[model samples]
Target: MSAITLEIDGNKVQVTDGMTVLEAADNAGIFIPTLCHHDKLEPFGGCRLCIVEVEERGWTKMVVSCVYLAAEGLVVRTRSDKVDRIRKTILELLLAHAPDAEVLKELAQEYGADKDRFEKDPSFCIHCGLCVRYCAEVKQKFAVGFVDRGIRKEISFIPEIAARECNACKECFPLCPTSYLQAAFVLTESLAFPAQQKKSE
Candidate 1:
């Protein structure tokens, strides 16, 4: 594959084919905030913090840098009024869900996002899909997944398999930014596997 040249934050960057905008920006030493992205794991664009503005086909549009593939002659802006507004909005919303997450709080502070802008929710999961993707991609367990959609969307342990896999696999715990999975691991009875079920027995 041919190397592609693109502009990120007014700096020219060269990346190989099949590289995402996030990777390209990283190659250029540009920093794009992200929550759900892991270098070892696949690109999961759950958090919109890495969004960038690009001009494509004469139309300016916002796109997620983590999954948006880099192309030749693409002009990308990692920071701008529009990009900051959208990223701050996303951080604020995430704060509502994970208020106790120190990582989230710090990011909100950096972005000047108002954590109190939205009503607080009991949920602590940011729905970054890190745990889910980690289980499937790295752990190869496929023991957890997402359920429902919209605001109701949640991470659900695959009951039948979760009862067999989750308790032994603690790898995803450290990968979570919020450390919210610790609470879920201890509290979610419905997702309990044999090890947890033994506590009741």
Candidate 2:
């Protein structure tokens, strides 16, 4: 494979061709924070947390590092004031939508986000699509897909059925980026804790 040289955070590094900016940063020991991006799956620029400023041919633009292909002579800034603001805003929006999600909470904390300025709707999905992608790509089941559009978009197993031909694989649960598929588990645990405490009393 051919090699591509790029400047990441002002440090020169050479990586294999066809590598994404995120992969190159990882190879160079630069940590670019991301959500909705997993090493085991193909890159999907849903979260926008990995946004970086890249300079190419005298022009610079913010691009999601996970999906942007790294090229020779590319100058990348993994973290900047603009990138930080974008990440914080994205996290804030995600937290507002899924406030009960521990994963989202942790990510928000990392960005020092304390409050959401926007109205939160608990019923909507963040639309990361990790569940559907995992089922289709990783599990090879193709059991689920996105239905509807915009805020109405959601993952469904099939037509008119709440469950898909999932093969009982349980792969989607862990891979879900927004914890939508595991909300039941968290709720059940929270409910059980109170009852268990009463039982001990």
Candidate 3:
């Protein structure tokens, strides 16, 4: 692949073709916050946390770096007042769901996100879909899925498929950004082996 040169945060970065702005920035050692992005998975842009300002066609516009392709002669600003405001807002929303996530907490602190900006929500999963994507794309299990829409959307395990497959393969455990999946796994195991639970106690 031919290398494409782009300017990120005032630094010239040369990256292979088909690389996203986020990947280019990462190659150049520029920090762009993201939640719904994992190197192992395709960019979903669910969290909208990696928004950056880019000069395109003489117009500066905010775009999510994780999905925006890097191009030659492109000027990107990873951090700016507008970008910071957008990222902080996204962080605040994520904290409402994954307050205990150390990754989220640290990123929130770095971006000066207000932990209390939004009302506390009981849900812990940020719904970044990492686990869902990992299960379907990488694991090929399709045991879980997102149900509902918008705020009502959530990860729901299909009991028949999940019970049959999830017990044997907890492959999506490490991909979750919150403890909700871990707790769910423990609950599933305890329910599956009540005898083991009693024996342990």
Candidate 4:
């Protein structure tokens, strides 16, 4: 892979081809907050918190850093008034689902997002997909996954797979950003969502 040079938060960064803006930022030690991105898993932009303003050829546009490919001569601003505003709004929406999620609260403080900005809909899952992806991609065990779609989407553990695989491989549990999410604080979360724990039946 050829080296691509870009600027992130005014710091010059050199990264290889096919690298995402978020990876470039990480290599340069630029902190771009993200919830849906994990080093061991493929880039998942489920949480738009890593959104950044990319200015290339004088046209500035916002893109999710985790999935946006880094390009030569790209000027990436990880934080700005506009970016902050967008993050605040996204945080507010996510906060509505997991109001007590410590990660959201900390990011909300940085972005001035009111946790109460939106009415609580508290499904308790922010849909970051960390557990789902980690289990499938890293562990090669499809124990936990999302069920339903759109607003009704929620995470569930596969009873049989989770029973056999997850009991010993609970690595994805800590990856959840929603701390104390309902009963997710422990392995018993598998029992909490017995409704959809899939494919294992």
lDDT of 2 at 42: 93
Runs in model 3 with CA error above 4 Å?
187-201
Poorest lDDT segment (10 consecutive residues) of candidate 3 = 191-200
Better of 1 and 2 by TM-score: 1
| Cα TM-score of candidate 3 | 0.89
Per-candidate Cα lDDT values, in order, are: 0.85, 0.76, 0.84, 0.85
The TM-score, computed over Cα atoms with residue i paired to residue i, of candidate 1 is 0.89
Write model 3 residue lDDT over 5-109, tens digit each, in one string.
Answer: 889888989999999999998888888877788888998988888899999678899998899999988999988999988888888988887787888889888
* Pairs of residues clashing in candidate 1: 163-193
Tens-digit per-residue lDDT, 1-201, candidate 1: 999999998998999999999999998899998989998898988888899999776888999999999999999999899998998999888888888788878878877999889999858888999999999898899877788998898887766776666666778888888887766666564444545667756
If candidate 3 were superposed on the true structure by all CA atoms, what would the RMSD be? Answer: 2.3
User: Which is the leading candidate under TM-score?
Assistant: 4
User: Cα lDDT for residue 80, model 1?
Assistant: 93
